[model samples]
Target: MGAISVKSKHLLGLKGMDRQDIADILDRAAYWERQPKVSDALRGKFVANTFFENSTRTRFSFEMAEKRLGAEVLNFSAAESSVQKGESIYDTMRTLESIGIDAAVIRLKPTGVLEELAGKLNVALVNAGDGNNEHPTQALLDLYTMRKHFGEIKGLTVSIIGDIKHSRVARSNLWGLTAMGANVAFCAPDTMQAPELEHYAPFVTMDEALQADIVMMLRVQLERHDKGLIRSAEDYREQYGLTAERAARMKPHAIIMHPAPVNRGVEIDDELVECGRSKIFTQMEHGVPIRMAVIERVLTS
Candidate 1:
């Protein structure tokens, strides 16, 4: 647990941020990762969890971070709120604020719903995920994980594979990988790939992407899409999925990563996940500290 020694507004992205902002946050997070010192930096702060979708990882990680920082957390979902009863989402945002919350960490089913709620709330707005658009904090954690592993980020080749169009992780990773000066690459089937994000990445094929310093995989959200997005999980497993053979093609020291709840054989082979080069488990550990950093920076400085 750590305290928020200073107060500040929320940080939604790297946009408009000078290089200093990125360095300080990363430095402080790296410091906290080592010390784990508990402080009342956020004493008396109140944060509300208004997730409109299912998320055990993000919600619980934030709750843990807030609590460790001495903030009170209020948790609930749209199904249990007025939004499910046909009330507007902004109205729901107002209702959450009505409870005198200090910050609102939201994850909604619709894309850009966070931006919609941002205008209406006086409290800080933390976007956990907004449809397939963005998950800023997730991106931050991923960067933190990368930084921890290599100690520097610039010019590092990182490939993220699998269902890009539907993955908030993919979108978030794109922003993060580019912001930190890492060379990013995306690979997937035509139907599942995100629109050419070459502006943010170097643009390489799966074979070429495998020559990365880092290799990450985004989960295939099978339940969310229509039939056309994927022909078959087995077919997908054959082509885009990271198999043991593909792992052999990767850089000798390259680390594999994923944002968990892996489909085992769908997006990545189970063997690679347990391999020595894999950083997937380490990424999960990075979530708590990176989230704590995000909570501290966004809610209190």
Candidate 2:
């Protein structure tokens, strides 16, 4: 809807967004896909990219999106910054603000940190990913990817597998997909499922999950191992990993997806990474323009 053009100054999460608002973003992203890839959409603007957590795709896709839009980018490295010396997140945001950064795309390990900072900041804020909270743009690009393939998101069945408890992608996708009329489900073990997601049914077995238009496998998130969420990679693969046998059982038209930094053998078989139905790489490619739409929308709003 016009809410994005009217009121959305920050993309903190997808929980509070309307269906039409979600549709608007996908529409805008589709529009951007056909236009020139490079533009001065954010010319003379300075955007800061701050990542407190390690990342490869999300961080770089954001950088590429900002550069493609012709915005001056300030890459904030937590390793070399005052944060390593105990500088608080608020202070770091203030530092960027004082220096006239027009917007910030941030990835942090703490949930709700972006919303807390959004209240105090003047520049536009884009939540690249937050701790098991939400990754709105990732969700947007996902919807775009599906729409590009199926001609629409409505009525399509989407099954998200793996560690839903710690996946911001799952949270984001649920909100975005369901809002656009898709039937969303989760396929994960009891420990891997999010108790908060009661509206959608989670299948405990892969057979039930494969009865969908899209099958998305999530990374195991080894960092959560210290918390005892998983035992070992072998143990995980044995229980819930997408093996070649399982992939073979999926519906003939069912496509595969993974939010990357994939542990190939642990989550999905290595060969399926580039399989005909796998949109894992295409999802990554969609990130740029979807983010371009987001950056333009937020900054101009």
Candidate 3:
């Protein structure tokens, strides 16, 4: 197996990652995708998947990646551990490190905690998803999918529509894509937009967003919003959803994507999810190799 190199000991977020580093990760992911189902790249290394919040894709993907690379895996769930009885996240991490874990894949509900943990923890830290900060692996998989389909990321117009304020995927994609020379636009209702990102990418109308080469939809994160901020799913769908009509209007070569747990007809039409242009499942398939590349980088870099 080929080695993936990165300067950072921890894969915190993509906010400051250089373009060449992102390209290397994507290229390494492609290599992993084409390899046999398993390898011994990380043989005998101990990695812990520590998730304080609930997850399906990120957790499973990381575990699969770890196993495929022949690493010894420890799965940590907050609810089932001492964390339930008041053990702090830092204490939990330290405990794992004390047990000789070489690296950790963490998903927590709080932002900035990963950065703090990265500083004090001896083991390498990989951010699975932290609050709404960034999910670098997701963005890396996304960039891989885009590149595989389009042959390059440069000059591709990617429109991210829906709940931008609560989407770590969007933030990571924004930072990664822009670094790789893609143009990004945000489209969302006023309450759903992240004003802090105004200087980074313009928030355009839905019609203008459809003109992009890639239309990526985000889940309507009702749990993150104040109750009643979104009056109804129907209301949000009519205004911001990628309905069938909207999908039809997109350019013939344009593709649709969602970092799922899709809300079906809410953020996007149900049928359009598996449509010719949709890369939803393809994105999931890419996650394993993308994460494999990341884990290999962290453990072996």
TM-score against truth, every candidate = 0.92, 0.95, 0.98
List the candidate 1 regions with Cα displacement exceeding 4 Å.
1-8, 15-18, 224-226
The per-candidate count of clashes, in order, stands at 5, 1, 0
Please provide, for model 1 over 1-301, each residue's C-alpha lDDT reduced to its tens digit, 9 standing for 90 to 100: 3443433476555444444566566676776677554657688988888888889888988888787777888997887787778998888878878889988888888876677566656889888888877787777777887888898888888888877777778877776667677888888777776565656655467898788898888888766346678767777778788899988988888998888878898889888888898888887777777777777777754
lDDT of each: 0.77, 0.87, 0.93
Q: List ranges where model 3 is wrong by over 4 Å.
A: 224-226
Candidate 2 lowest-lDDT run of ten: 1-10
* Model 2 segments more than 4 A misplaced: 1-6, 223-227
lDDT of 2 by residue, 245-281 (tens): 9999999988998888799899998999998999999
Best by lDDT: 3
Please provide, for model 3 over 130-177, each residue's C-alpha lDDT reduced to its tens digit, 9 standing for 90 to 100. 998999999999999999999999999999998888889999999999
Q: List the residue pairs that clash in candidate 3.
A: none
Candidate 3 Cα RMSD (Å): 1.0
lDDT of 2 at 29: 76
Score candidate 2 by lDDT.
Answer: 0.87
